[model samples]
Target: MNLQDLQWGLMMMVVGMGTVFALLALLMVVLMGIGRLDRKRPHLPPPPAHEAAPAEATPTVHIVADGLDEDQVAAITVAVMTHAEHRRRLAAPETRAHAPGSQLFASRWLAVGRGRESSPFPRERR
Candidate 1:
Protein backbone atom coordinates (compact mmCIF):
# COMPACT_ATOMS: atom_id res chain seq x y z
CA MET A 1 0.00 0.00 0.00
CA ASN A 2 1.06 3.65 -0.53
CA LEU A 3 2.32 5.69 2.47
CA GLN A 4 -0.63 8.07 2.12
CA ASP A 5 -3.16 5.16 2.22
CA LEU A 6 -1.45 3.67 5.28
CA GLN A 7 -1.56 7.02 7.08
CA TRP A 8 -5.24 7.45 6.19
CA GLY A 9 -6.10 3.94 7.54
CA LEU A 10 -4.15 4.64 10.76
CA MET A 11 -5.99 7.94 11.21
CA MET A 12 -9.36 6.21 10.73
CA MET A 13 -8.43 3.50 13.22
CA VAL A 14 -7.37 6.09 15.84
CA VAL A 15 -10.55 8.11 15.32
CA GLY A 16 -12.78 5.03 15.69
CA MET A 17 -10.99 3.86 18.89
CA GLY A 18 -11.02 7.40 20.32
CA THR A 19 -14.76 7.73 19.63
CA VAL A 20 -15.49 4.43 21.44
CA PHE A 21 -13.31 5.37 24.46
CA ALA A 22 -14.92 8.84 24.63
CA LEU A 23 -18.42 7.34 24.63
CA LEU A 24 -17.47 4.87 27.43
CA ALA A 25 -15.91 7.66 29.54
CA LEU A 26 -18.98 9.86 29.05
CA LEU A 27 -21.27 6.97 30.08
CA MET A 28 -19.23 6.39 33.27
CA VAL A 29 -19.39 10.09 34.18
CA VAL A 30 -23.16 10.18 33.61
CA LEU A 31 -23.69 7.09 35.78
CA MET A 32 -21.53 8.55 38.60
CA GLY A 33 -23.48 11.82 38.47
CA ILE A 34 -26.76 9.91 38.70
CA GLY A 35 -25.44 7.96 41.73
CA ARG A 36 -24.42 11.21 43.46
CA LEU A 37 -27.84 12.72 42.81
CA ASP A 38 -29.50 9.60 44.26
CA ARG A 39 -27.34 9.86 47.39
CA LYS A 40 -28.33 13.50 47.89
CA ARG A 41 -32.09 12.66 47.92
CA PRO A 42 -33.70 12.18 51.37
CA HIS A 43 -34.29 8.65 52.66
CA LEU A 44 -37.81 7.21 52.38
CA PRO A 45 -40.11 7.85 55.38
CA PRO A 46 -40.61 4.97 57.87
CA PRO A 47 -43.68 2.74 57.61
CA PRO A 48 -46.95 4.16 59.01
CA ALA A 49 -47.30 4.17 62.84
CA HIS A 50 -50.27 1.76 62.92
CA GLU A 51 -48.33 -0.93 61.02
CA ALA A 52 -45.03 -0.28 62.82
CA ALA A 53 -45.45 -2.76 65.68
CA PRO A 54 -42.91 -5.61 65.42
CA ALA A 55 -44.10 -9.14 64.64
CA GLU A 56 -43.86 -11.74 67.42
CA ALA A 57 -41.05 -14.27 66.98
CA THR A 58 -42.29 -17.85 66.61
CA PRO A 59 -40.74 -20.62 68.75
CA THR A 60 -38.77 -23.35 67.00
CA VAL A 61 -40.33 -26.82 66.92
CA HIS A 62 -38.43 -30.10 66.69
CA ILE A 63 -39.61 -33.39 65.17
CA VAL A 64 -38.30 -36.80 66.29
CA ALA A 65 -38.72 -39.44 63.61
CA ASP A 66 -37.65 -43.09 63.73
CA GLY A 67 -35.04 -44.51 61.27
CA LEU A 68 -33.59 -41.09 60.29
CA ASP A 69 -29.98 -39.99 60.97
CA GLU A 70 -29.04 -36.63 62.49
CA ASP A 71 -28.27 -34.96 59.11
CA GLN A 72 -31.60 -36.08 57.60
CA VAL A 73 -33.43 -34.88 60.70
CA ALA A 74 -31.73 -31.47 60.51
CA ALA A 75 -32.58 -31.06 56.83
CA ILE A 76 -36.21 -32.06 57.46
CA THR A 77 -36.39 -29.68 60.39
CA VAL A 78 -35.09 -26.75 58.31
CA ALA A 79 -37.49 -27.53 55.45
CA VAL A 80 -40.46 -27.78 57.81
CA MET A 81 -39.51 -24.59 59.62
CA THR A 82 -39.12 -22.62 56.40
CA HIS A 83 -42.43 -23.97 55.07
CA ALA A 84 -44.17 -23.08 58.32
CA GLU A 85 -42.71 -19.58 58.28
CA HIS A 86 -43.82 -19.07 54.70
CA ARG A 87 -47.33 -20.30 55.48
CA ARG A 88 -47.56 -18.13 58.56
CA ARG A 89 -46.63 -15.05 56.55
CA LEU A 90 -49.29 -15.82 53.92
CA ALA A 91 -52.10 -16.75 56.38
CA ALA A 92 -54.33 -14.24 58.20
CA PRO A 93 -53.37 -13.48 61.85
CA GLU A 94 -56.67 -14.89 63.18
CA THR A 95 -56.24 -18.27 61.37
CA ARG A 96 -52.53 -18.70 62.07
CA ALA A 97 -52.89 -22.21 63.64
CA HIS A 98 -54.16 -23.76 60.37
CA ALA A 99 -51.26 -26.13 59.78
CA PRO A 100 -51.25 -27.68 56.30
CA GLY A 101 -50.91 -31.47 56.00
CA SER A 102 -47.30 -32.72 56.09
CA GLN A 103 -46.11 -33.76 52.66
CA LEU A 104 -42.54 -33.94 53.97
CA PHE A 105 -42.97 -37.60 54.85
CA ALA A 106 -45.03 -38.50 51.77
CA SER A 107 -43.46 -40.77 49.11
CA ARG A 108 -42.66 -38.85 45.91
CA TRP A 109 -42.53 -41.99 43.73
CA LEU A 110 -45.96 -43.28 44.78
CA ALA A 111 -47.85 -41.06 42.33
CA VAL A 112 -45.20 -41.17 39.55
CA GLY A 113 -46.24 -42.92 36.33
CA ARG A 114 -44.42 -46.23 35.87
CA GLY A 115 -45.72 -47.50 32.54
CA ARG A 116 -43.94 -47.20 29.15
CA GLU A 117 -46.73 -44.83 28.05
CA SER A 118 -45.56 -42.36 30.72
CA SER A 119 -42.06 -42.00 29.20
CA PRO A 120 -40.97 -38.33 29.06
CA PHE A 121 -39.34 -38.81 25.64
CA PRO A 122 -41.21 -40.66 22.89
CA ARG A 123 -39.52 -41.82 19.64
CA GLU A 124 -42.63 -40.82 17.69
CA ARG A 125 -42.34 -37.20 18.88
CA ARG A 126 -38.69 -37.03 18.01
Candidate 2:
Protein backbone atom coordinates (compact mmCIF):
# COMPACT_ATOMS: atom_id res chain seq x y z
CA MET A 1 0.00 0.00 0.00
CA ASN A 2 1.84 3.16 1.26
CA LEU A 3 5.63 3.50 1.57
CA GLN A 4 5.39 3.76 5.38
CA ASP A 5 3.30 0.53 5.59
CA LEU A 6 5.70 -1.21 3.25
CA GLN A 7 8.66 -0.02 5.35
CA TRP A 8 7.05 -1.22 8.57
CA GLY A 9 6.21 -4.61 7.03
CA LEU A 10 9.75 -4.96 5.70
CA MET A 11 11.24 -4.02 9.07
CA MET A 12 9.08 -6.56 10.85
CA MET A 13 9.97 -9.20 8.27
CA VAL A 14 13.65 -8.47 8.67
CA VAL A 15 13.42 -8.75 12.45
CA GLY A 16 11.52 -12.03 12.16
CA MET A 17 14.02 -13.42 9.69
CA GLY A 18 16.95 -12.31 11.85
CA THR A 19 15.44 -13.92 14.93
CA VAL A 20 14.79 -17.20 13.05
CA PHE A 21 18.33 -17.16 11.59
CA ALA A 22 19.88 -16.46 15.00
CA LEU A 23 17.98 -19.36 16.57
CA LEU A 24 18.99 -21.66 13.72
CA ALA A 25 22.63 -20.62 13.99
CA LEU A 26 22.60 -21.19 17.73
CA LEU A 27 21.08 -24.62 17.17
CA MET A 28 23.73 -25.45 14.59
CA VAL A 29 26.52 -24.38 16.92
CA VAL A 30 25.07 -26.51 19.70
CA LEU A 31 24.81 -29.54 17.40
CA MET A 32 28.39 -29.06 16.20
CA GLY A 33 29.61 -28.92 19.80
CA ILE A 34 27.63 -32.05 20.61
CA GLY A 35 29.08 -33.78 17.55
CA ARG A 36 32.60 -32.88 18.67
CA LEU A 37 31.82 -34.23 22.12
CA ASP A 38 30.48 -37.45 20.64
CA ARG A 39 33.61 -37.82 18.53
CA LYS A 40 35.91 -37.06 21.46
CA ARG A 41 34.16 -39.57 23.71
CA PRO A 42 32.22 -42.20 21.87
CA HIS A 43 29.72 -44.04 24.07
CA LEU A 44 30.69 -47.34 22.53
CA PRO A 45 32.85 -48.75 19.73
CA PRO A 46 31.11 -49.88 16.53
CA PRO A 47 31.61 -53.65 16.27
CA PRO A 48 30.26 -54.79 19.61
CA ALA A 49 28.48 -51.95 21.40
CA HIS A 50 27.68 -51.76 25.11
CA GLU A 51 24.32 -53.42 25.44
CA ALA A 52 22.54 -56.23 27.24
CA ALA A 53 23.91 -59.64 26.30
CA PRO A 54 21.93 -61.09 23.47
CA ALA A 55 20.84 -64.69 23.27
CA GLU A 56 22.93 -65.27 20.13
CA ALA A 57 26.17 -63.76 18.83
CA THR A 58 26.82 -62.30 15.43
CA PRO A 59 28.26 -64.80 12.94
CA THR A 60 31.28 -63.89 10.87
CA VAL A 61 30.68 -64.62 7.19
CA HIS A 62 33.73 -65.57 5.14
CA ILE A 63 34.07 -64.73 1.46
CA VAL A 64 37.31 -66.54 0.75
CA ALA A 65 36.06 -69.65 -1.04
CA ASP A 66 36.81 -71.52 -4.26
CA GLY A 67 34.41 -70.14 -6.84
CA LEU A 68 33.76 -70.66 -10.51
CA ASP A 69 34.45 -67.73 -12.82
CA GLU A 70 36.79 -64.88 -11.94
CA ASP A 71 34.07 -62.47 -13.02
CA GLN A 72 31.65 -64.13 -10.60
CA VAL A 73 34.08 -63.72 -7.72
CA ALA A 74 34.59 -60.06 -8.55
CA ALA A 75 30.86 -59.48 -8.79
CA ILE A 76 30.26 -61.29 -5.51
CA THR A 77 32.94 -59.24 -3.76
CA VAL A 78 31.36 -56.05 -5.04
CA ALA A 79 27.92 -57.19 -3.94
CA VAL A 80 29.13 -58.14 -0.48
CA MET A 81 30.83 -54.77 -0.05
CA THR A 82 27.65 -52.95 -1.04
CA HIS A 83 25.56 -55.13 1.26
CA ALA A 84 27.86 -54.52 4.22
CA GLU A 85 27.80 -50.76 3.74
CA HIS A 86 24.02 -50.72 3.48
CA ARG A 87 23.67 -52.87 6.59
CA ARG A 88 26.04 -50.66 8.59
CA ARG A 89 24.12 -47.53 7.64
CA LEU A 90 20.80 -49.11 8.54
CA ALA A 91 22.00 -49.89 12.08
CA ALA A 92 23.17 -47.14 14.45
CA PRO A 93 25.93 -48.15 16.91
CA GLU A 94 24.94 -46.54 20.27
CA THR A 95 21.16 -46.82 20.12
CA ARG A 96 21.06 -50.15 18.27
CA ALA A 97 24.07 -51.78 19.94
CA HIS A 98 25.96 -52.30 16.63
CA ALA A 99 26.01 -51.60 12.93
CA PRO A 100 26.84 -54.32 10.41
CA GLY A 101 26.95 -51.78 7.58
CA SER A 102 30.26 -50.35 8.75
CA GLN A 103 31.81 -53.81 8.58
CA LEU A 104 30.19 -54.21 5.17
CA PHE A 105 32.04 -51.07 4.04
CA ALA A 106 35.31 -52.54 5.35
CA SER A 107 34.55 -55.84 3.66
CA ARG A 108 33.76 -54.06 0.43
CA TRP A 109 37.04 -52.19 0.56
CA LEU A 110 38.83 -55.44 1.32
CA ALA A 111 37.08 -57.16 -1.57
CA VAL A 112 38.18 -54.34 -3.86
CA GLY A 113 41.78 -54.81 -2.71
CA ARG A 114 41.84 -51.61 -0.67
CA GLY A 115 42.23 -53.49 2.61
CA ARG A 116 45.10 -55.16 4.50
CA GLU A 117 44.42 -58.58 2.95
CA SER A 118 43.74 -57.97 -0.71
CA SER A 119 43.97 -59.86 -3.98
CA PRO A 120 47.02 -59.34 -6.17
CA PHE A 121 46.55 -56.95 -9.03
CA PRO A 122 46.90 -58.23 -12.56
CA ARG A 123 49.51 -55.59 -13.41
CA GLU A 124 51.18 -52.62 -11.74
CA ARG A 125 49.57 -49.23 -12.17
CA ARG A 126 51.19 -46.76 -14.52
Candidate 3:
Protein backbone atom coordinates (compact mmCIF):
# COMPACT_ATOMS: atom_id res chain seq x y z
CA MET A 1 0.00 0.00 0.00
CA ASN A 2 1.05 3.62 -0.48
CA LEU A 3 2.51 5.64 2.48
CA GLN A 4 -0.50 8.00 2.38
CA ASP A 5 -2.92 5.05 2.55
CA LEU A 6 -0.99 3.61 5.56
CA GLN A 7 -0.98 6.99 7.28
CA TRP A 8 -4.74 7.38 6.77
CA GLY A 9 -5.33 3.85 8.18
CA LEU A 10 -3.21 4.67 11.27
CA MET A 11 -5.10 7.92 11.80
CA MET A 12 -8.43 6.14 11.52
CA MET A 13 -7.26 3.47 14.00
CA VAL A 14 -6.12 6.14 16.47
CA VAL A 15 -9.42 8.02 16.18
CA GLY A 16 -11.47 4.82 16.71
CA MET A 17 -9.40 3.76 19.75
CA GLY A 18 -9.47 7.31 21.20
CA THR A 19 -13.24 7.52 20.78
CA VAL A 20 -13.78 4.21 22.66
CA PHE A 21 -11.36 5.28 25.42
CA ALA A 22 -13.02 8.68 25.82
CA LEU A 23 -16.51 7.13 26.01
CA LEU A 24 -15.37 4.61 28.70
CA ALA A 25 -13.73 7.41 30.72
CA LEU A 26 -16.86 9.53 30.48
CA LEU A 27 -19.01 6.55 31.65
CA MET A 28 -16.72 6.11 34.67
CA VAL A 29 -17.03 9.78 35.57
CA VAL A 30 -20.85 9.74 35.22
CA LEU A 31 -21.06 6.62 37.46
CA MET A 32 -18.87 8.31 40.08
CA GLY A 33 -21.08 11.42 39.99
CA ILE A 34 -24.19 9.28 40.41
CA GLY A 35 -22.61 7.55 43.42
CA ARG A 36 -21.74 10.92 44.95
CA LEU A 37 -25.27 12.22 44.46
CA ASP A 38 -26.73 9.03 45.99
CA ARG A 39 -24.53 9.51 49.06
CA LYS A 40 -25.62 13.16 49.39
CA ARG A 41 -29.36 12.33 49.02
CA PRO A 42 -31.28 12.43 52.34
CA HIS A 43 -32.36 9.05 53.77
CA LEU A 44 -35.46 8.40 55.86
CA PRO A 45 -34.82 7.92 59.57
CA PRO A 46 -35.10 4.32 60.92
CA PRO A 47 -38.56 3.39 62.13
CA PRO A 48 -39.08 3.78 65.89
CA ALA A 49 -38.98 0.52 67.85
CA HIS A 50 -42.34 -0.55 69.32
CA GLU A 51 -42.46 -1.84 72.86
CA ALA A 52 -43.06 -5.60 73.20
CA ALA A 53 -46.51 -6.73 74.34
CA PRO A 54 -46.90 -7.90 77.95
CA ALA A 55 -46.47 -11.64 78.62
CA GLU A 56 -50.14 -11.85 79.76
CA ALA A 57 -51.21 -10.58 76.34
CA THR A 58 -49.61 -13.58 74.54
CA PRO A 59 -51.10 -17.09 74.37
CA THR A 60 -49.08 -20.03 75.77
CA VAL A 61 -48.77 -23.68 74.62
CA HIS A 62 -48.59 -26.57 77.13
CA ILE A 63 -47.34 -30.17 76.56
CA VAL A 64 -48.65 -33.05 78.66
CA ALA A 65 -45.94 -35.48 79.93
CA ASP A 66 -48.27 -38.01 81.58
CA GLY A 67 -48.16 -40.69 78.81
CA LEU A 68 -44.47 -40.61 77.87
CA ASP A 69 -41.98 -42.56 80.05
CA GLU A 70 -38.54 -41.08 80.86
CA ASP A 71 -36.69 -43.36 78.42
CA GLN A 72 -39.10 -42.65 75.51
CA VAL A 73 -38.99 -38.92 76.25
CA ALA A 74 -35.19 -38.98 76.26
CA ALA A 75 -35.08 -40.92 72.98
CA ILE A 76 -37.52 -38.49 71.34
CA THR A 77 -35.49 -35.51 72.57
CA VAL A 78 -32.24 -36.99 71.20
CA ALA A 79 -33.84 -37.76 67.83
CA VAL A 80 -35.25 -34.21 67.61
CA MET A 81 -31.87 -32.63 68.48
CA THR A 82 -30.05 -34.83 65.96
CA HIS A 83 -32.58 -33.98 63.23
CA ALA A 84 -32.25 -30.25 63.97
CA GLU A 85 -28.42 -30.43 63.79
CA HIS A 86 -28.59 -32.32 60.47
CA ARG A 87 -31.01 -29.77 59.03
CA ARG A 88 -28.81 -26.88 60.18
CA ARG A 89 -25.76 -28.43 58.51
CA LEU A 90 -27.67 -29.00 55.26
CA ALA A 91 -29.02 -25.43 55.21
CA ALA A 92 -25.65 -23.80 55.83
CA PRO A 93 -23.80 -22.28 52.83
CA GLU A 94 -21.01 -24.41 51.35
CA THR A 95 -17.58 -22.99 52.29
CA ARG A 96 -14.14 -23.49 50.75
CA ALA A 97 -13.17 -25.64 53.72
CA HIS A 98 -15.79 -28.25 52.81
CA ALA A 99 -15.43 -27.98 49.00
CA PRO A 100 -15.72 -31.24 47.07
CA GLY A 101 -12.32 -32.77 46.07
CA SER A 102 -10.61 -30.44 48.59
CA GLN A 103 -9.83 -33.47 50.75
CA LEU A 104 -7.30 -34.69 48.13
CA PHE A 105 -4.92 -31.88 49.13
CA ALA A 106 -3.71 -31.36 52.69
CA SER A 107 -4.25 -27.60 52.35
CA ARG A 108 -6.06 -25.18 50.00
CA TRP A 109 -2.69 -23.59 49.10
CA LEU A 110 -1.35 -26.93 47.82
CA ALA A 111 -4.26 -27.21 45.35
CA VAL A 112 -3.08 -24.33 43.12
CA GLY A 113 -0.04 -24.19 40.79
CA ARG A 114 1.00 -24.70 37.18
CA GLY A 115 4.28 -26.59 37.93
CA ARG A 116 5.82 -28.98 40.44
CA GLU A 117 5.34 -27.97 44.08
CA SER A 118 8.13 -25.87 45.64
CA SER A 119 10.03 -26.92 48.71
CA PRO A 120 11.59 -24.88 51.48
CA PHE A 121 14.79 -27.01 51.51
CA PRO A 122 17.54 -26.70 48.87
CA ARG A 123 17.51 -29.46 46.20
CA GLU A 124 20.44 -31.86 45.93
CA ARG A 125 22.55 -31.46 42.74
CA ARG A 126 22.25 -34.31 40.25
Residue 8 displacement (Å), model 3: 0.4
Kindly report which residue pairs in candidate 1 clash with one another. Answer: none
Q: What is the lDDT of residue 116 in candidate 1?
A: 40
lDDT of each: 0.75, 0.74, 0.75
Question: Which runs of model 2 end up more than 4 angstroms from their true locations?
Answer: 41-126
Question: Which should have the higher TM-score, number 1 or number 2?
Answer: 1
lDDT of 2 by residue, 26-88 (tens): 999999999888785546756966675566667554555574466678888899889878877
Best by TM-score: 1
Positional deviation of 3 in candidate 3, in angstroms?
0.5
Root mean square deviation (Cα) for candidate 3: 18.3
lDDT of 3 at 58: 77
Worst 10-residue lDDT window for candidate 2 reads 92-101
Per-candidate alpha-carbon RMSD to the true structure: 19.8, 24.8, 18.3
Per-residue lDDT of candidate 1, residues 38-86 (tens digit): 8866779987666533565565445456867667898989998898788
TM per prediction: 0.33, 0.32, 0.32
